[model samples]
Target chain A: MGEFEIFGMPVSLGTMIFQAVIFTALIWILKQKFLSKLVGAMESRRESIDNQLNLAETYKHEAEEELLKQREMTEKATQEAKQIIAKAREEANIIVKAARKEAFTIRTEAYENERRALKGRGAS
Target chain B: MHATRPLVQIFGLTFDLSIIITSTIAALVVLVFAYACTRHITAKKPGKMQNLLEWVIEFVQNIMVNSMGRKDNLFILAGGVGLILYLFIANIMGVPFSFIAGADHATWWKSPTADAHVTMTLAIMMIVYTHFIHIRLHGLKNYFLSFFKPFKALFAINILEQFCTTLTLGLRLFGNIYAGEVMLGILAAAAMKGFQSGIFIGIGSSMLAAIPMMIWQVFCLFIGAIQAYIFVTLFMVYIGQRVNEATT
Candidate 1:
């Protein structure tokens, strides 16, 4: 190792060994302090993003469900309104029919009494 | 014409102080960047530094996944990020300010990766780590058998490939960075010579030198970034070969 020279630069075995050690220490320090934290931060960011997406999905699903429920209620109210209108129409028809029958009976009774009085006056 | 470096001897070993100092500066710069980036990490709203740090991390992860088809190994992911950060910072550290001092013209500051020893050290470390992982993943017997592969005649060739990978990985980075610096130095020297010539020639020649210098500086920055990327990509590729081959 002593007489090794290339391009006027002496290649030192000592320096090589020493630098390897230095590089190892550097890797260890960087792994412990910098890399781990950065990875952790990245992971946490990913987790947060995922959580937010999930929450949004849940909200969307809930909104859809609520919309469905509102539509069903509106449909139910419409059906009820139709049923009420139908029932009122039926009641009105029944009342009109009964009033017409009563009016007819009263007219027949009046006509019968008038005939009976004419016949009795003729007999007298 | 080769530059001289200040040397110190301790315990029968020669240590280059310049390389040590420059490398330490590079390491310190990387550490400071890491610290500042991680000081107040936030998941919801990351600051610029944190964003930068995460970008590098994800970038490295993407490289690994693209190459290795796996990213469950957090240790390797972090290692990749660290390697890139160190190499990039070291490769570009000397670009703006390279200090050659004293009568010896000893380089007080320069890119540590410009030195073969530093790059070789990293390459060796990374290669050794890959082999370790290969062995750990496939046991010693399987790892040894890997050399013989589909054809037993290719044993020697496989063994040679390991050496080649290491050599190329280290040398590629060293060559690019060193050549850039050398060219920059030549331009600077020309500028200095031009400055000493005469009034008009000095200004004219120096201006001529400055254009290339500026252009080379930008080129060096581009090369530094590219070299760092290449080193890490190759590293992941090597590791991927080691790790993925076991399953198949």
Candidate 2:
């Protein structure tokens, strides 16, 4: 009546099961009320910190890349502008030289006509 | 003194309420301690109580991680903190207060963990949980087939191993806590005997008996903690074995 024998082992299954059920309730309450909440809060805090660190790192790398790209683009633009300006100045100089040569040719042709006219008059 | 004294009847079920009452008090003590220690926990500027709570939580977490390699889910779901706290508190329950109260004062309140019924229940639960995990993870076929692995000769040994889990775990905790409590009881009896004797001899003898009794109480602290740790360690080990691919 006190304790029963099961498989040659004396045990109070009722008490054992009762205790188990009691502890199960205890763990459930503790988990729901305290342990789970605390652990979750700690995990979230850690995850948030990790996320912020990652965001900061990504932003830093992106900013550095943007700065490098802009510097390269500025250099490229300056080189191209200088080359265009130099080429334009050279073309203007060539135009000025051609105009001077054309004027010289016209002037020489007029002088020849005048000389020829004077020669013809003197000869006549 | 009888440990299983009938306390009260609720409905039709008569019960031995010593373990229940002691366990409830132990549970409440742990609950209050936890609540007080962690109620004002802050992410920044944590107090000593918070630090202690964090340390205990992390310690249990580390045990799980180390034993189960951080992959298994049971390591997370089965909180070792409560088990350790409960067992440890129950193991030391006799240190602060324990008395024999009955019609003849033959019924006693010792450590709840000292009770075989309570320890067996905890052990059975752990083993059941481990077996459930093993079966779920490895599949029922594999779980059963695992007993006969490395040739079919290991079948009986494997069965015994399963039975032994609850037996050993429960008996070990019960034996240790019970022994310690019994020793304290002996010391208390000695002190009482000496204190109750004739005049001059009583005072001197009682003082002498009280000395060892106090010393043993101090020693019981270490024993309680070590027993709790061993219980937790064995539990995690069992879980680890079950979850792993190896049947043994």
Which runs in model 1 stand beyond 4 Å of their true positions? A1-9, A72-124
A1-124: candidate 1 lDDT, tens digit per residue: 3437877756677778778877888889999878887898898899999999999999999999999999999999999999999999999999999999999999999999999999999999
Q: Taking the tens digit of each residue's C-alpha lDDT, what string does model 1 give over B107-163?
A: 878898998889988998889999999999889999999999969999999999999
For model 2, the docking class works out as incorrect
lDDT, model 1: 0.89
What lDDT tens digits, residue by residue, belong to model 2 across residues B48-115?
87677667777888888788776235334445888988889899888865788667564457788888
Question: How high is each candidate's TM-score?
Answer: 0.84, 0.74
Question: Worst lDDT window (10 residues) for model 2 chain B?
Answer: B70-79
| Best-matching candidate per lDDT | 1
Give DockQ: model 2: 0.17
CA lDDT of each prediction against the hidden true structure: 0.89, 0.78
DockQ of each: 0.42, 0.17
After best superposition, candidate 2 residue B135: deviation in angstroms?
A: 1.8
